[model samples]
Target: MLIALFQILDFLLRIVGWVIIGQVIISWLFAFNVLNASSSGVRGFAEALERITAPLYRPIRKILPDFGGIDFSPLVLLLLIQILRMLLGGLAVELTYSDA
Candidate 1:
């Protein structure tokens, strides 16, 4: 039962990490003019990514100092996700040993 719960949480963290990566890639494409944001489909996809990631970035943005136009919030959030995953893994190990 505990392992199942840990697996679910790990899956969720992995999904969030992928979403962050996707948003970063999309932003890069837009910046380089590789993607046409003028098209409805592209615009909608970018907007959807933004909507999903904005909330995650908000608090991090508050704590991080601005670097002119460069945003590090996504990087910070990714690090946070990694840290949480590590903690979860440690807890799982500890719990499993306790049960044994």
Candidate 2:
């Protein structure tokens, strides 16, 4: 049914939101040196996160100016992910109501 399809789409949006958030947190810690490069677990997760987040971040990352030691792509990427979550969630809600 339409409601069930909406649920699936909503779940996917939520997953994307969570991945974006996790990427932000992981990138933040790594950028700040809180996690050492030699920390294999963190490194692995970062690598995985990179694969998911890179396509989103790459274009913006290219245009950003280097602020000494700070990286801001993750913040921008977080904002974009939030926007996507809200927009997709709204569509999902509309679909549920449209079925009525």
Candidate 3:
């Protein structure tokens, strides 16, 4: 049962990681003028991503120093997510061994 829980958490973390990646790509597109900022569709998509990721980035943003116009919150969040995933994986391994 605990293993199943860990699997679920891992899957959710993967989804969050993808969402962060999507936001980063979208921001790059906007920055490069590849995506139309005037378009409602593009604006809506960007807004949605911002809303979803804002909470996750808030704390990290506070802790990280500003680098001109650059944002490192997403990268920091991704790294933290990877670390959590590794911990979950290790715990799951221990559980599997103990069960046997």
Candidate 4:
């Protein structure tokens, strides 16, 4: 049961990590204005990215110290998601080994 739980968490963390990466790429395109704001595809991706990534960024953004006007929320969010993935993966491994 615990193993199953850990595996589930690991899977979810991986999915969230992928979404974050996608959001990061999409954000870069938007930042550079390479993707038109009026295009339906861009708009759809923008909305999905916002819906997925904003909650993770909100708290991190609040606590981040200013650095010459640059925002570090994305980096922080990435780090956190990666760390969660790692933790879940480790738990999954332990659970598997213990079950064996």
What is the lDDT of every predicted structure here?
0.97, 0.79, 0.98, 0.83
Q: Please say which candidate is ahead in TM-score: 2 or 3.
A: 3
Q: How well is each residue in 22-90 modelled by candidate 4, as lDDT tens digits?
A: 888887898899998889988997898889889888999789877986768888877887888787888
Deviation of model 2 at 26, angstroms: 0.8
Q: How far is candidate 3 from the true structure (C-alpha RMSD, Å)?
A: 0.7
Ordering by TM-score: 1, 3, 4, 2
Task: Flag clash pairs in model 2.
Answer: none
Candidate 4 lDDT score relative to the true structure: 0.83
Q: List candidate 1 segments past 4 Å from native.
A: none
Model 2 Cα displacement at 2 (Å)? 1.4
Taking all chains together, each candidate's TM-score versus the true structure is 0.98, 0.66, 0.97, 0.80
Pitting candidate 1 against candidate 2, the one with the higher TM-score is: 1
List, residue by residue over 1-43, the lDDT tens digit for candidate 2: 6657766776776787688889878877877899897989879
Candidate 3 lDDT over residue span 15-100, tens digit each: 99999999999999999999999999899999999999999999999999999999999999999999999999999999899989
- Summed backbone clashes in each candidate are 0, 0, 0, 0
- Pick out the ten consecutive residues of candidate 1 with the lowest summed lDDT: 36-45
RMSD of 2: 2.9
Off by over 4 Å in 4: 93-100
